[model samples]
Target: MSKVMKGLLLVLAIALIAVPASANLVATSFGFPVIVQSGTTSAFNQDTAFASDFETLDIDFPVFGDGFELGATAGVVAADGVALTGTANVLPFGPVNLAFPSISQTVEQTQEVTHTDFAQTNEQAEFAYPFVGVGPVALPGFGFGW
Candidate 1:
């Protein structure tokens, strides 16, 4: 994998671990889409819209929780494959951070990820051309404790 992809995966993994719920969490996103069209470019200019709904769920078992856990779910949808995603982690310092006062605080940090993608079918309705595209992600820096 590219260094950037590796870094992103690392950051995501850290985000899951940094949050506290008396346990640890591992998460992934599941995407599903629906498309509708008249097979004509003119239809879009006249007035048209398409819809898709997708959701991501976080599932985990805490090492200290005796392998039991609570799950977290987030979702989003858009017209023509555009989407925005956001997630928050609330952390309680508890005994661990309390011992080290400098790190003790109850705060919520939120991360947002946005992406837009699209593809097209040819006259033969063949899913070819790959319709090349690009997606971008703007993630905010970490939010500290209160």
Candidate 2:
């Protein structure tokens, strides 16, 4: 048609030829929490004790004849205790994306353990003997020995 119109058409054709065409549209977004926690807690305690005691006595007397007396005593005690504990192990993950259509994954884990033990023992022993007289005659007395 006119000179101005021809020049405009030629410039428009050149611009179209220079630009490259895109067939696919892609968009990406990412967000994560600022805090991440991971830790372990443990504790242990123990207690123990021991004790023992012993006593003994012996006596002899003559009352219008012959008499005898004796006594003995013993004791023992013991105790033991133990304890163990684990609070927890915490692990947390914000988010993970593997591929195409925005796949998200979250993971968390926690664990705890506790244990206790106790033991005790006690023992005791005692012995005694009585005196006897028959018509001014003394009789032998018997008692536990060892």
Candidate 3:
């Protein structure tokens, strides 16, 4: 074997040997929006009331800017009070789904959110941020928790 080939193999072996058993993604800048909304013109009448909320989840690495997720909440108090759930793949930078007055669909939905009687703001929006590096020295994860 050539001297260069032997050296390369040796380096690879040492790197592999030093790598941790557990591996995880490393994040750079981490952020997500916990959007809240209320008060519209009409929700089918005074008898019927509706409220919708939205939140986004993102994981960012140095190379990739943002990965996206959309979660929402909806409630209707017409003849009977009802709640619905749904979700969708959203744009990392913006809300992926939207509703417009099309005069076509009656029950319009953007996404679904878990029902929280009292919705909390985005406190841990940037949690689980991972740390970086290549082989022998890479931080695990950060943001809030590591």
Candidate 4:
């Protein structure tokens, strides 16, 4: 082979062997240290009882920014409660799944919450929708969404 070709092959051989050795597969889990704690919301109420037999799951992540999120919640949360009728993006927590309103129409719902109950003000874990212009006052319902 030519002198240049032989030199090129030798360089290639050294690079192939050295690359993997020097460049160890480096994978580091990067996340801000966050203290895990159960979040709660104060009592909230609605005019009429809208959500019953609801499945509210709160999902908290390890990161947050101005009106944004970086990753999914630390884990799947399975909590249930009643809240107002609106988008799910208004809740105080990170990401929440309110599996109510019967996504599947096949399931038969025998009972509905009556106006007498009206979903009285109650404390729910990680689910609350505060009324605008009200200071720290949350109205009853599984609200907050994106």
Candidate lDDT scores, in order, read 0.41, 0.41, 0.44, 0.43
In model 1, the Cα lDDT at residue 38 comes to 38
Q: Candidate 3's residue-wise lDDT over 1-146, tens digit each?
A: 99999999999999999998986865444334344544434223123345665544443221232443232223233444655443322224454434222122234346444432433333222333345544455555532464
Candidate 4 lDDT trough over 10 residues, lowest sum? 98-107
- Per lDDT, the best of the predicted structures is 3
lDDT by residue for model 4 (59-118), tens? 433334686754332233344764434322222344654232212233334455544322
Q: What's each prediction's clash count? A: 0, 0, 5, 12
Q: TM-score of each candidate? A: 0.16, 0.17, 0.16, 0.18
* lDDT (10s digit) by residue, model 2, range 21-131: 876543432232233344454545554544444444332211112333121112222346544432221222246222212123444444344446555445444543443
Residues 1-146 of candidate 1: C-alpha lDDT, one tens digit per residue:
99999999999999999998684544432232233333633222233355555555443221125554233223343668888774322223554211111122344445455555555554434321112112332222211221
TM-score for model 1?
0.16
Root-mean-square deviation per candidate:
49.0, 54.9, 39.2, 43.1
Model 4 scores a TM of: 0.18
- Model 2: runs farther than 4 Å from truth? 26-146
- Candidate 4 Cα errors over 4 Å, as ranges: 1-3, 15-20, 23-120, 126-146
